[model samples]
Target: MKRNSLLLLWLFIFWSVLIWSAIDPKDYPTWFLEVFPALIGFVVLAATYRRFSLTPLVYLLILIHAIILMVGGHYTYAEVPLGEWMKEWFGLARNDYDKIGHFAQGFVPFMIAREIVIRNKVFKSRGWMHFFLLCFVMALSAFYELIEWWVALLSKEAAAAFLGTQGYVWDTQSDMFFALIGGLCAWVLLTKLHDRQLREL
Candidate 1:
């Protein structure tokens, strides 16, 4: 199949699932709101699909990240079924799947930035690239936290569901920290892989 066609197919599947999830009564209101970014990202990517050829690994990562968001939306993060089950099995205090989602929010975006930087040759300084990538992920996380705060101010109940703190006093701090960790991990894991993918492209 043509690359553009494949991209369209993937997008169609994503949106179909999203539309279904949006109307599903079992999902929390925050679920749809949380998915807003991914939906927007899809539209942006689709618009540029013909001009870009992303690595299969990057596509897989994006899909995984989207699924994480969808799952969090469905269960309101703190009460995610899988996380709650894991918590019970491991005897933890609360569900931690939301952490995973937030981490990927940074992790996946790290590769997206890396792809853009390498593909565009945005900067000549390799060390600075990594530094800027870390800073970028942190800034993104902080901005998201602010968004959460704003949502809380506007709609306390819905925002509580969106925050998905699960009783952690340092939820916001930990979210950013995990995102930082994920950014580092993405750099470590995808740097060489992305280089290889770039060569193939």
Candidate 2:
């Protein structure tokens, strides 16, 4: 019962943040671009809950990612207040909240992919599994950059906010690099805990 209540609370918080994000954003299109993945994730989780429920750590990470998405949607990544605060405090070149989003993009998805791969016994060799994971995460990261490019071309009005490039010529490249780093770090930092959780699951 307590576990069920906690799950409900988790859902309530997600919906609350999503609603707040949707009420009024920096721009409607940019909001959709950012929040769409969270919406898809919610659907996928619901669909798989009974037959293939993920580990609690994965679920928690997904929620955190969704919250990051919604927050970025509400303010647009370049103008996020938290990122702005950090930028000023640290004397940085630009708001880097988008980097957080990119990092989570790699980190959370790598966990999900690793869980799915391990649970299914997809690779006989650990080395091969790691290789596949790196490829998958990097591909995902690069594809997302392509998405930003395509979207920028489609909607000039929302391009700047949605892309969150902030006049940096290498923003897209850096985003992918951060994602690669995130993926590598996640594998190093999370493999042990994730393996324990997999045993429990």
Candidate 3:
């Protein structure tokens, strides 16, 4: 299929799934908010598609990240169905779905950046690229923490759901730490695989 047609088809599927999820009786108000970012990302990706095609692994990573966000939105992270069940099964203190979402926010984006840098040959130093990628993900994770703080300051109720910390005092630190791990893992796992895919492209 042509790139434009494929892009349109993906967009159609994305919006269709989002709409269906939104109208579902069990859906949370935050679900709509999650879709907003995915829509924005989709527009950006579509605009750049002609200039750059993502590897299949990168594409799958993006989809996984989107699903994580959507699922967190559906149940407000702290109360996500899967996490709740896992909590029960494992006898945990609280649901940790938000952790999964934040981790992917770092992990998937790391690969996205990796693909961009490697494909475009953005920097001469591969080591520098890897260092910068890790730092970038950490910075993003920290910025998101600040956003959560700001949201908490603005509205107590909304912030409760938004933070999804579930009374964990060290949640912000832990979130960033997980992001760091994710960034490292992404570099370790996808670098060579991505390079192979780039060859095919």
Best model number under TM-score = 2
Model 1: residues with Cα > 4 Å off, grouped in runs = 1-9, 23-28
Of 1 and 2, the candidate ahead on TM-score is 2
How do the residues 59-79 of candidate 1 rate in per-residue lDDT, one tens digit apiece? 768877887777677667877
- Clashing residue pairs in candidate 3 are none
Give one digit per residue, the lDDT tens place, for model 2 in 1-201: 355776898799999999999997988989999999999999999999889988888888999999999999999999999999999999999999999999988898899999999999999998899888888988999999998889989999999999988889999889988888888988999999999989987
What is each predicted model's overall lDDT from 0 to 1?
A: 0.83, 0.92, 0.79
Candidate 3: Cα lDDT at 84: 88
**Which runs of model 2 end up more than 4 angstroms from their true locations?**
none
Could you tell me which residue pairs clash in candidate 1?
A: none
> Which of 1 and 2 is the better model by lDDT?
2
- Backbone clash pairs in model 1 (N, Cα, C under 3 Å; residues 3+ apart or in different chains), count: 0
The TM-score ranking, best first, is 2, 1, 3
Choose 1 or 3, whichever is better by lDDT.
Answer: 1
Task: List, residue by residue over 1-201, the lDDT tens digit for candidate 3.
Answer: 665675576667666666665665234545655556676777887787778778877876877777677667666788778998889999989898877887897899899988888878998999999999999999989998987788788767677777887889999999999899899989887788888988988
Task: Give the winner by TM-score: 2 or 3.
Answer: 2
Please report the TM-score between candidate 1 and the true structure: 0.90
